[model samples]
Target: MLEVKDLHAFYGKSHVLQGVSLSVGRGEIVALLGRNGAGRSTTVKAIMGLVSAQGSVRFKNEEILGLKAHEVARKGIGYVPEDRAIFPDLTVRQNLVLGIKDPRKRGRWSVEEVFSLFPLLAERAETAGGVLSGGEQQMLTLCRTMMGDPDLVLIDEPTEGLAPKAVEQVGEFLTAVKKRGISALLVEQKLSISLQISERLYLMGHGKIVFQGTPGDLRANEGVRKEWLEV
Candidate 1:
């Protein structure tokens, strides 16, 4: 459903993505793994047009490179950044309401449904987002994006710094997304969770994809893991 070819992105003179290429099929979870400075995050940002990029990005057979970020989102792509960007001043419910692309048409997910999925969020539906705990904020960010009913979600570092329980909840959330037939390109540092959930994986190093294979294939090739993934 999503294809990126020869994608290049930059921060002024410093190039961050150097011809990165990858694809995510419908209903498939493809994990993008790498260490810091490997350009994993830049790859997604480029696809979303958050940064200036020169390359071919096709979603559902349509070219999307250089489109505005909101245009990309309207084309059925959702993004959840590593920072868990949420409106601190808004109530949890209000934050969720903002994610709906069109309230007139029902989407695959609803606030009530997601709140039921994560009762922690349901309990704090009226609470201000700034007052929520870190894990709670993460959940709110993810659920808010889900409220958009995207065909695919670009999630960066969902499990980073979360407690084990929160990490596990993130995994469950991915499973729920898959059950709803949503594909994702997950940029993550947590190999265990990625290996457990992803059908295929790509490892990036220096703005290039160094490895592309199944989870078992990734495990079999210890050299790639050692050189590109391990700390």
Candidate 2:
């Protein structure tokens, strides 16, 4: 469903993503794994048009490299950044309402349905988003993105600082997304979760994809893991 070829991105002459290439099939979850500076997040930002990029980014066979971020989003892609960007003063429900692409048309997900996925959101529906716990904020961001009815989502560090239980909840969220036939490009640090949930994984090093294979293949290749993944 998504393909990136020779993608390059920069931050004021510091090239962060250099010739990165990968693909995500329909209804498939692909994990991008690497150390802190391996350029995983830059890859997604380039695809989303949040950064200036040069190369080919195609979703469903159409080039989307130069489109603006909002334009790319209208093309059925959602992004959940690592920072958990949510409106601090808005009520949880109100924040969710803002994610609706069109109020007149019903999409694949609803506020009530997302509330079902994370009951705490329903309980805190009227609470200010700034006051929620870190985990709750993360959940709210994920559900709010889903509220747009995206065909694919680019999630960056969904489990970064959460407790174990919250991490498990993230796993559940990914499973739910997969069950609904949504594609995901997951940038994650937890190797265990990535190996458990991803059908395929790509290991990045020095701003390029160094390995691409199944979980089993990654498991069997100790040298690749030690070089590109293990700390």
TM-score of every model versus the real structure: 0.99, 0.98
lDDT of 1 at 205: 93
The TM-score of predicted model 2 comes to 0.98
lDDT tens readout by residue for model 2, 32-147: 99999999998999999998889899999999999999999999999999899999999999989988888998999999988887899999999999999999999999999999
Compute the lDDT for candidate 1. Answer: 0.94
Question: Which window of ten consecutive residues has the lowest lDDT sum in model 1?
Answer: 8-17
lDDT of 1 by residue, 141-166 (tens): 99999999999999999999999999
Q: Give all candidates' CA lDDT scores.
A: 0.94, 0.93
Q: In candidate 1, list every pair of residues with a backbone clash.
A: none
Steric collisions counted per model: 0, 0
Task: List candidate 1 stretches off by more than 4 Å.
Answer: none
| Residue pairs in candidate 2 whose N, alpha carbon or C atoms collide under 3 angstroms | none
Summed over model 2, clashes come to 0
